[model samples]
Target chain A: MNDQRPRILLADDEKAITSNLAPFLERGGFSVTVAADGQAALDGIAALHPDLVILDVLMPRLDGREVLRRLRRAGNWIPVILLTQVGEAAERALALEEGADDYLNKPFDPSELVARIRSVLRRVTPGQPPLASAWQLACPPEAPGQPALALDRRSRRVSLDGRTLDLTPKAVALLEYMLTHPGELLSRERLLDAVWGWDYPAGTRTVDTRMAELRRALGDDPARPRFIETLPGEGYRFVARVVAA
Target chain B: MKITWRDLLLAALPAALAGVAATVLRLSLGRLAVLLLRADIGTALVLLGSSLSLFLLVYLGARRAGIARSRAAIERHDRESGEARRRFIHRLDHELKNPLTALRAALANLQLALSESDRAQRVGDVRLQAERIGRLVADLRKLSELEERPIEQLPVDLPGLLEEVVEAARSNPAYAGRELRLVVSQVPWKLPPAVGDRDLLALAFYNLVENALKFTKAHDPVEVRASEDGRALIVEVADRGPGIPAEDQPRIFEELYRGANARGFEGSGLGLSLVRMIVARHAGSVSVRSRPGQGTVFTVRLPFDARDRAPVPAAG
Candidate 1:
């Protein structure tokens, strides 16, 4: 692997997956190191110290989950991305809790995996702290007079007027993306691509339905303006004034 | 066998002798002793013994005559009740099927008589009603079948089954504008044959997937997915529609039941019943988890195979 280019350690038991991903990541301008199994990936990690590691959940000789547990236990805060075979939320949360930086489900689009890798790499560079740790992923901070919206990154929860909002998984993803890019008028297409994986259709009513659900969850009147403002022809924008915490 | 004077005299001799002895003893004893052994007590005791003997003799003769007749009557009654139950179910099944079959025939005839302009509308209505009948017949058959037979199964590829169901649903205009997605791991390995009756399993999955697509709004994607969890294969049909009401979850799988929100929706209320029957026949179980408006997930778990009784090792 080249020293200057960001190195990603890819570990999956299946050769086809790693092989398929190699060209895709190389095209995206990243140095890729492939490991056939979990133990090999961990050994490579200790030696090579790659910028990111994408681990598969099912593998012989130290499974992905155990690998993650050990790495985190060793205080190696190397950003890790878990590859899940099933898109089960509980399993994904378990991986995240075990110190995985992010995860992508199998049969995932190459572009989406690369995007997540970039997102994690951008957050946890050596010189800088993780942006997700510094800022709330779901909502802005709402102290005494700070802001109307407060987001709790660790919990993936949002709050308004001191009341917590219960949002679904997809709703949280969309909200997190919106919070990361505050004040930009994000088009529906762009928002769909960024939040929902690239595999989802571009023009889908799912976004509209979810936004309606989000508005309902946020206690905002759909007919009137509140935290989220609809741009009519444009997409939704988070317009609440941020009060400094 | 003929009674003679000599035999009568012999029978009376013992009683006469005992009477004489009692008289002598009464005379010889003192008044206090005679009073203590009262004369009426002996006579009452003799009468009580004779009556008990007579009662036993009469009872045994009557029991011998009545037992066989009573046993036959009870057995006949039991057989009659069982026959009645069978006849009732048979009649109900036949009665329920007759009108639907008649309507289907009528529709077919109408289709022949009608020209191209009205043919499409008539044919579509016919198909919808025919499906309703098919669902009803399936329910009745399942209700009866599950009571008697277990699944006789061959290996079924679930993905292939799902593809056929989705294709069938798509062709129906009622499912227009909805996106149906079949999401499975690309592992490409087939599930160990879940020994299950193919026709019954197909009906169950078709009902679940079709129902999911129907409840969802236009253009909303309904996802059907399968995955291995331990030794069980879990197949789920999930809909992002207004989910079943919480109060209805426990009872939705019941026969001829529809949730309060489902009252106005177009359904026969037999879809879930048929699904449950089929699952039960395959030695499997089904459950639903949902909150109103969040969407619902119906999960079915079937054993992997006979030899693999132990739970499949959890994903390493």
Candidate 2:
């Protein structure tokens, strides 16, 4: 294992940003590799197993969100910094819940990007136990027949109360995040940074758009929400009490 | 459908003329001869003349009536158009109010937060609010320009125009709060020297850059770059952030169409609309390519021929 320099994988479709950022990170004393899209980033990460991964939220042939999911599923504990554009607060929260270390919004200063990369790297470096001890705790699977979450990994299908629910990829990701947090209040900005990744070029209304869709799929009303509740000037929280079967 | 005063006058004209003419004719002919002729051809001639005179009078009355109705129709159309204009003005005023209100609030917050260490933080709030107002103003300007004098054909120095635009955008009161980076690529530049009015074209590019920077988060660097692609000059402003939704791509440049993702982002939703209008005015075009989770790339293509050169005054 090369301990001389921390290796970071930076992936984005834009050549200018990627090229400009690579040198900036190198100046910050981090070894960086540029990937054009999500799949390429994933392939690069698999080959390199870098100390940190900086991924753009939007990409072709599989988005950043899906790539992050695969990374978690593979049990790769590599610290990641997701870049999102505006309006991705809710999505950012989902990424955090899925175990991403940090995130940033696009048009971000190269210096700040380096700073955040350092922050995440410091938290989860090799031979150093991560600072947040809660993440280290192994969670037991849910008990049987107690509000069971029947998720079919192959079909991307979900059901609650014997009724099938059709939710968008982003909404499903949010639900999964909320389920993991279970009663924790998630701010809109934080959520956006989590799911969408930094530089997910949008405004705050992306959360509202995906939330509205989620509510429609879950048979929840915005005026009188059952599962997801608003925090009033802060963000949203998933309030449902569940015990997996 | 209601009857007018002209209709009444038309109805009365024929009868009035016929009564006066008949009385005069009766006075000319003596009663004895008239009584003898009344039994023969004289009576037939008088009856025929009276009927023919009445027919002519009725025809004149009907023509006058038709003219009157048409005049009323024109008046009605004018009134409808006036109302429509008033409604449009009302809508414009309503749109203008939101940004102004936000700007006021942001300024107030800045004044309050001045003593604190987070004054720098509050600066962003103030700047964002101001951007909201700037966007609204840009939208209004665009509406007025497109409606009034439209630019048709003019040569443009793409690089010079871009530089001026970036400078204007960065200097804007709303945008002065953030760090702005303008990158220009050096190539054998081909530009028609005597392009359009530097002011109007500069304003168009300024609006586009302002939008890119406005939509970006604070503390982040907003990028402005220009490069020539084949026969077209391509200017792009790309941010590394959450991009616009696929559904909104088509409508982003439409007047008054705010995307679902733009809530809490200070904008009157007219920046892109204005950009399109200005580009179209110069015989150029603008387009957006975006993905939901990725950033957006806004492209402005201005066609130019190096041979067409005219020395126009630079913008003051």
In candidate 2, residue A105 scores what lDDT?
Answer: 61
Quote each prediction's TM-score. Answer: 0.39, 0.32
Candidates' DockQ values? 0.01, 0.01
Interface RMSD of each: 16.4, 16.1
- Candidate 1 regions off by >4 Å? A1-3, A85-93, A125-138, A141-148, A151-157, A166-207, A216-245, B1-316
Cα lDDT of model 1 by residue, A1-245, tens digit: 53587898988888887788887898898999999888899899999999988999899898998998898777777887778532223433454357565555554558778777776776565633233324444345344544467766557777875778877666776776565445556668566544543212212344665687788887777566556788888788866543213
lDDT of 2: 0.64
For candidate 2, the per-residue lDDT at B90 reads 71
Docking class of 2: incorrect
In model 2 chain A, the worst 10-residue window by lDDT is: A132-141
Q: Summarize candidate 2's per-residue lDDT along B1-316 as a digit string, tens digits.
A: 3466775665566557657655655654454356566576677567557656765665676567667767776887788678657755775776777767877776777788846656776777767766555546544644664654534244456676676566666656777777767777664544444345443556566666777777767765677777654556667777655789988888678666667777566556666766787677666788888766667778887655556632333565
lDDT of 1 by residue, B183-290 (tens): 875464555556665445666887888888777788667888887766688899998888988898987886666678776576556678768877877888999998
